[model samples]
Target: MTHTPQKPIGSGFGPASTADEVIRGISLTGKTVVVTGGASGIGIETVRAFRSAGARVIVPARDTAKAKAALATMPDVIVEVMDLPEPTAIDRFASRVLSLTDKLDVLVNNAGVMAEPLTRDARGYEMQFAANHLGHFQLTCRLWPALVRAEGARVVALSSYGHRRAGIDFRDPHFERREYDRWVAYGRAKTANALFAVALDSIGRQWNVRAFAVHPGGIATPLACHMLPSEIEASQIFDAEGKPVIDPENNKKTPEQGAATSVWCATSPQLAGMGGVYCADCDIAIALPSDGSAEMHGVRPHAIDPISAGRLWQLSEQLTDATLD
Candidate 1:
């Protein structure tokens, strides 16, 4: 299939559509979904909407207490401790999740660290890349059985506009020999997120398992904790009104709006047969320009290229020692 721009098909959804609005009539009774970083921000909103739609949502969190406190009022939501930075912890967490359920309808790889300083995980990989990409990579691989069992399982990888910074540095993903730049590291990780969907959809479609990469748009959330105040100020994300300017030109979106596309990709009947596509503003993205600037609509070709996807997949396997079993 050629990579063409996918229009809305008159789904009647827009950038302002809320998570609840996306699932207005979709009943998810008996559906099982696992959302990483579901304790706060857009993830929490996603959980609330899914649970409201009758799905049993499980949150794999690094801190169960924080997650439980945040989700105290929600029903059918369970919080389990699972640290993504620790590879061994991820293995155990996946095992526990498999033991609890035989089918997984959705897997939202929502948790991620932004442009943090140079640091390494327990496995000595870059912190941002490891936590955001490698962790989810292993989790999905380990849970492949359940996903296949569910039939038509959708895996949503939360990519970002930050992918414009750089594509995956396959030569040295760990940055062992190169100088570390936080934004570039984040860019690489987000790009990996998109390519992951492409590669996964290529392999998973036979089982009716589709994958999507989402640019959640720009949102003002705790995800900015790692950035300096000067950086935030220079970005001009805030206005004189002390609110984020919602100029589509800059691609800023509220958390509710940011979470909308993900929910749409997860439940929209419009995308029943589509997979391996990048989505933004509740619609399929077109091919992005090559300047690596965030001044356009659509995914970058390099980010979704099948060749790059395969290479990144192999690199991820080596870094995390995970196989799609």
Candidate 2:
């Protein structure tokens, strides 16, 4: 097939696509998968889709008890304690993964905190950037060997359309010298997620490992924990009655719909050799202006630029005291 990474390859699924629908006929009986935040909302849905397809899914959550309870009935699933913002925790988890398995077929970096009040991690990094980007960065690096061992591993990073707000602010990433805005911080972190995939695929493709960034649509889930009612109202995602409306024109997505892209990217045969692209609605996104308009549906240049991706990877290496091989 011809390779046009910027354009959708006519994936049969669309806005209304569900995880089960997209994954139909695909069987993963022996594959090992790991999903961060695989307990609730679309994360749970994604876990279910993969497990139903016969994949062994290992979910690492900060609240192990909560994850266990939420995922109690799911088969072929395991929940472990892992706080992404804590580098120590990520290191320990990655070590444990190595001790248990020699290879990882798929890794979904799905756990993330959205717009929230200003908070910092132990290293003084802003919470959103620390947990969403740096933590995944460090974890991917630590797990690079196992991914390589798989020979065809797929790593999916959950980005967002909010990436249009800003790219990485290399100097003040932690809100040290500048004022903080929740949306701007969240945007930067999401952009980092997309760029990380670009750089990772550029580097890892030689080993037959592909990476993708996923923009799960605007779903009303726990991801909105930090946004106030007024903020959500301003976003206009809900009806006057305060119930979610599944309007494609408005970017609304049910949790199962939200999970379609992640699972699709992880296992679809059509994307066998493609990577480093932003995906939404189960298709590769085109480039668009960063004008904050919903009509600008494709990715922005800044989010997929090789130079930007490479620079962020180097900076992430410095911040986490980790290196990319």
Candidate 3:
């Protein structure tokens, strides 16, 4: 398969576009969608948009009560329990989804943990990497049959510009050797998110199940609860009065706006033949230069490199004991 270029294709939507706008006029009446983090932040907005378009949405959350409360207004949206960092929970959740429907039209790996103090999963893998990458990796493989059944499905992995912090450290992804830097761990996990898309798209295209990685811009959400006030202030995503700034042009966006690109990637007709590209602002992100210039935006070579993607896939399968068949 020819690689899709990491350049915008004039999607006619800009950074300011909302999920409602990107999905306008599209109907997903009989479709089924599974958004991992569908109960909070941009995830909720994404679920709202899909529901508005008439899709049957399922949200698998680690905290079912919180998820149910957050989604209470949308009574039709299904809520199940699954923790990304837990392999047994992921398998159980996948089984439930398959039992509910034979096909899955869209799968958004939107749930993730950002920079946090060193923590590990049951297998001793770094928490951020475990939940953000390996967890999704296992879940996707478990749902492979459902995806193929759809015949024209899409998987959107929520990556971030944070990936620019560091590439995958193959030798010690779990921080077993190197000193643990929260930002570096977060970056490596985010990079894994992007690379997962790159590899999944390459493999799934044969089954007409394409995948894309999304950078939802910066939005003030519960996802940032782990961030310190000083860090948040330094990031400049908030105003003097402590209000979350809304500046889509500069990547600071509202939750609805942040959900736009994920919605577009999953349902847009404009991207019908596209896959395996990093997207932001409702369009394919341009590739960044290798010289560290223009680092704040665009897809970096390490994130989209096919070779790295393949290697990550192999590593993920080995770590999770799951494989896409």
Candidate 4:
């Protein structure tokens, strides 16, 4: 939280590491996990990986029909209707989940919107902030009892390199007075995600409920819906012939690979006593500066700042009307 870097531990895994590989020989038997956005992309792979290791997973989706259809074959995975940005539905969903389980081993706040056009929830809050940060914040707070009951629960927030795009503004967070830039909004939301984890860990570590933030790396997915074709081309994620290339030097990952960090954070014995850290490639990452170069990678100071994290926790509670404290 103070920008003290966490050295990489040589996890025997790297960006290309798959979820199965990360969890190989490990058992999640009898563990209970909830993964938002588990119906598709890396979330789907995350659900699959955890289930393969014998964990029971609950997937909350905005579209229950699509979720059910996508997850229909997985008898062990439960698909529930949950649109994160909506406060009332989130509350109802939390109530239902509590009624079903007394404890939770893992919570993956992985659902998020990328660079969409300006949009707000029913509360007139910005969509990315509300959904990516506040929704998970409220859900985690509401589920506090079960998390504590687990005695060693872990919460994973899906942050990103987008965090480097912008830190929390404190004021004008919703773009009410300022003009909106989708990337900046998204980056701030992601920064909030990481900060949320840092703050949660500081509060919950005493109860054995730790938190972590993960950068899943750049993967081609439907999450790219908002990216313009020219922007994508300029980014060089795809070659001129439309073939996908990961720029091996930069370490782009497959969905399974992207999911490895979340699973690792959730179940790795190596990380037993560590919490409130940002992770990537199945290991805790070092905090790096904003060089404004595409080749650079690491958590930013603001994203993991303790002061901002604490303030955000307070703000999140105020916004969502939910908190364990």
Candidate 5:
């Protein structure tokens, strides 16, 4: 696939566009949305904003009881037990969802595990890569039919700045013989998320289904809980005032702020004819410098490279034997 270097298309929204702001005039009354990790943090907030906009949000969570309790006060929000760490669970959950809904307007791959001690999923894939990328990859394929049935469906893969640190290591993704650094694993997974969107868009565009990868910016959310206090201190994410340090000039978005990009990508008319782009601050991101360094302006070349995306897709199919066309 050939990718064009991205340029903002005058979205009329910026870094501060809240979720509510993005869907201001839209009504999702009969639309169905699936949000992973919708029981907490930006994910839950995303659920709330979508539900309020009239979408019946389905939250697939690891803990059914916990998700039910957390969403007890929210109407039109249903909880289903699904654990991404277990591929079988995801398969089961997707089957159940398909039985209930014929069309899906939005699918948000928002659940993720950050830097943690090395671990593996039930299938023996590295935990960070499995939960963060492959699980979502499989789920999207399982849900493809429903997405194609909808008039216009969108898939949002939540990527992050951490992608800057690493690219997918197709040669040794399972970390079978190599020492593992948690951050590097997380980076690989996040990079996979971006690549997934690239390939998904290539295949789904004909069905009026577009895929977008998003960087929600720096938000103080549970997604960062794996880091120690010392790491947080060194991150300079907080200000002397103890509030989340926001550098307006540099453009850091809060959770509500961060969510804007996903919501925007999912709904904004500005993207009516668009697909397969890395988005931040509620707009398509500028392309990274072709040199491929961490300190670049846009997505890493490897992340959206067609050859890499296709390679990962084929590996993923072999890993799970999930061949969805």
Candidate 6:
């Protein structure tokens, strides 16, 4: 598969564009969407945008009660139970979804964990990588038939600018040999998210099921619960006076603005033939050089490399024992 160039195609929407704005005129009356983290943070905004556009939305959450409460105000939004870190739970959830729908129009892999202490799932996989990438990988594979049925389906993986921190440590991804650093682990997982999109898109495009990875900017979401106040401030997401900065140009964003790119990647007609690229601020992101001198914007070569994406896909299939075919 030829790679899609990483340069932006001048999508009219900018960083400040909110999810509602990007989806304003589009109609999804017969569409069905699954947003993994659709109960909180920018996930809520993502669900709202799709729901507003008349799509059927399903939100899978680990905590059913909390998810229901968070989304109670939104009528007809289905909330299901699925824990990303557990393989069995993911399979069961996918089965449930498949039983309900023959065609899935969109899937947003938005749920993720940020920097946390070194921990492993039952499979001994690192927590961040397990929940953020492998789990989504399994879910997408399990839902493969439905996605292909849609014929023009789109999958959006929520990656991060933090991917700049590290690439996949294929040898020590679980931190078995190397010492664990929470931030590096987070970066590795985020990189996996991007690569998953590349690989998935490469294969899925044949069935008109394209995939995209999105950096939803920095927002004051519950995703930061693992970080300290000082850490948040140090990350520049918060001001010295303890306020969340809302600078879109600098990647700081509100929940609605942060979800813009994900919504765009999923529903924008401008991206009909495009996939396998990293997106941010409602446009395909520019690819950064491998030299590592560029600022914390755009995608690194490793995250979008077709070879790495294929390698990661194989590794993920082995780790999760899941396959699309």
Best by lDDT: 3
Q: Please estimate how well model 2 matches the true structure, expressed as its whole-model Cα lDDT.
A: 0.90
lDDT of 6 by residue, 162-239 (tens): 899899988878999999999999999999999999999999988989999999999998899999767876779877
1-325 in candidate 2: lDDT tens per residue?
2223777889978878999999999998888899998998899999999999999899999988889999989845888789999999999999888787899999999999999899999899999999999999999998889899998999999999999988888888888998999999999999999999999999888898899999999998888989988988988778899898787545788999999999999999999889889999888987775545465478888898889899999999999998755
lDDT of 5 by residue, 258-314 (tens): 778888888788788688888888888877765256463467777778888889888
Report the C-alpha displacement of residue 296, candidate 3, in angstroms.
1.3
**Full-model lDDT for every candidate:** 0.86, 0.90, 0.95, 0.87, 0.85, 0.93
Q: Give the residue spans of candidate 1 off by over 4 A.
A: 1-10, 241-250, 289-294
lDDT of 5 at 257: 80
Q: Single out the weakest 10-residue window by summed lDDT for candidate 4.
A: 1-10
Which scores higher on TM-score, 4 or 5?
4
- Tens-place lDDT per residue, model 1, 114-196, is 99999998778999999999999999999999999998899999998778788998889989989999999999999999999
lDDT of 4 by residue, 1-325 (tens): 2332456877888878889999999888988899999998899999999999999898888898888888877876987788898877887888878888899899999999999899998999999999999999998888889899999999999999789899998888899999999999999999999999899999888888889999998878889899999889877778678876765337567788889999999889888878898998888987775435453577878888899999898888888889894
Name the regions of candidate 3 deviating beyond 4 angstroms.
Answer: none
Query: How many residue pairs clash in each candidate at the backbone level?
Result: 1, 0, 0, 0, 0, 0
Candidate maximizing TM-score: 3
Better of 5 and 6 by TM-score: 6
List model 3 lDDT by residue over 79-151, tens digit each.
9999999999999999999999999999999999999899999999999999999999999999999999999
Candidate 6 regions exceeding 4 Å error are none
Task: List the candidates' TM-scores in order.
Answer: 0.95, 0.96, 0.99, 0.95, 0.95, 0.98
How far does residue 79 in candidate 4 sit from its true spot (Å)?
A: 0.8
Q: Give the worst 10-residue stretch by lDDT in candidate 5.
A: 289-298
**Candidate 3: deviation at residue 82, Å?**
0.0
